[model samples]
Target: MGPAERSVLVAWSTFTTTFTATRAVTHWIRDGHGPASGGITVGGRHFHHYNIGIALLSAVGAVALRGQERHRRHPVTAMAYGAANALIVDELMLLLDLKDVYWAKDGRTSVDAAVGLIGVGGIYLAAAPFWHRAARELASTAVHRPA
Candidate 1:
């Protein structure tokens, strides 16, 4: 595969892994099965993962846009981008509503959003080669067939 395609595949893999791991860990914590206390806190404010995701995304995006090709296509950069995306998606509902609804019924939208993104990404990656082939085949048939 080309470098760009390889980078995308790496990113997609990272995104899926990060998303799944985040969900599992959060569930464990929420269920009170872990040793750690509640959410991360500095002073009196609770820090959310999405906040980190946004910062990482901004940094990564800037570097990718202005850095050298090698830097932009690096696996590390891809992983960071993927993980950032997952973190943001994991809290989509909260972002939409501007409130903490992580365990509420309204929070289900976050899961739905994550699933939708993962499915779309998976389909695109899996069908990448087929898409080009299908397009070529259709073009050839059109060229040879009567109008």
Candidate 2:
């Protein structure tokens, strides 16, 4: 309802979309169904998705901390943060394994992580108001009720 809550919803949606799209595209390419080009390569080294995610996150943080007031709450920043988070989360297994296993069975870990994040985010958003109300009531009872 409030701006903060709305922003969170938007960010979550963005994250979900980015995560799903990235996974789908990667899987398609891995299955030899997409373009011949595997991915971006620079200077004989392949750039991972997480690398771009990190850069986007850094840019978002820098802009949020140093840019003008109008830039702080911009939707672009929120979307960037979401996409960055997705990219990083999608590579959880790769990071842990320290190798390219994205197309292997182990790669399912990324899907699990992404699904878990979505579930948790949804639960948190849905229950936050109830939690806040309960906390408020508890505080009021502590202050007003006899000891």
Candidate 3:
């Protein structure tokens, strides 16, 4: 995998871990309990842009990796990967109703987090091959692909 893919995976993993850990610890602060199945509420707010930061961070990582002496121009894949992540998260938000955050004793997190999860998962799936050399591989693929 390339640096871009690796960066995204690292970021996504970190992001999810951070969010999950925050939720577990701050469940009491957010509301009565942790994330729920059907959907969870966030400060009673309708919209939460969790992946915006993701996109920005991934974009930066991709750009930097491309400029580095060794790698080729696979930054676009990173961009595509990052874009996929953001797009998936946004789409998941709407589909899963991510506003609602709560978890039952059964370890059931809300469906609200589902979309974002899918998005995150998608990023990994895309980066599975070259997460370490993701930037280069993506660049290589970009050049080899017909269109």
Best by lDDT: 1
Candidate 3 similarity to native, TM-score = 0.33
Off by over 4 Å in 2: 34-36
Model 1: per-residue lDDT, tens digit, 34-114? 665576777889888998889989989988789887899999899999999999999988999999998899999998988
Q: Look at candidate 1 and give me any clashing residue pairs.
A: none
- In each prediction, how many residue pairs overlap at the backbone (N, C-alpha, C within less than 3 A)? 0, 0, 22
lDDT of each: 0.89, 0.87, 0.50
Q: Which candidate is the best by TM-score?
A: 1
Question: Following a full C-alpha superposition, what root-mean-square deviation does model 3 have from the true structure?
Answer: 10.1
Per-model TM against the reference? 0.89, 0.88, 0.33
lDDT of 1: 0.89
- What tens digits encode model 3's per-residue C-alpha lDDT throughout 96-145? 55343233332233334544574657776676666657788888999999
Which candidate would rank higher by TM-score, 1 or 3? 1
Show where candidate 3 strays beyond 4 Å: 30-111, 114-123, 130-147
lDDT of 2 at 22: 92
Once model 3 is optimally superposed onto the true structure by TM-score, how far is the C-alpha of residue 137 displaced, in angstroms? 14
The candidates, ranked best first by TM-score, are 1, 2, 3
Q: What 10-residue stretch in candidate 1 is worst by lDDT? A: 33-42
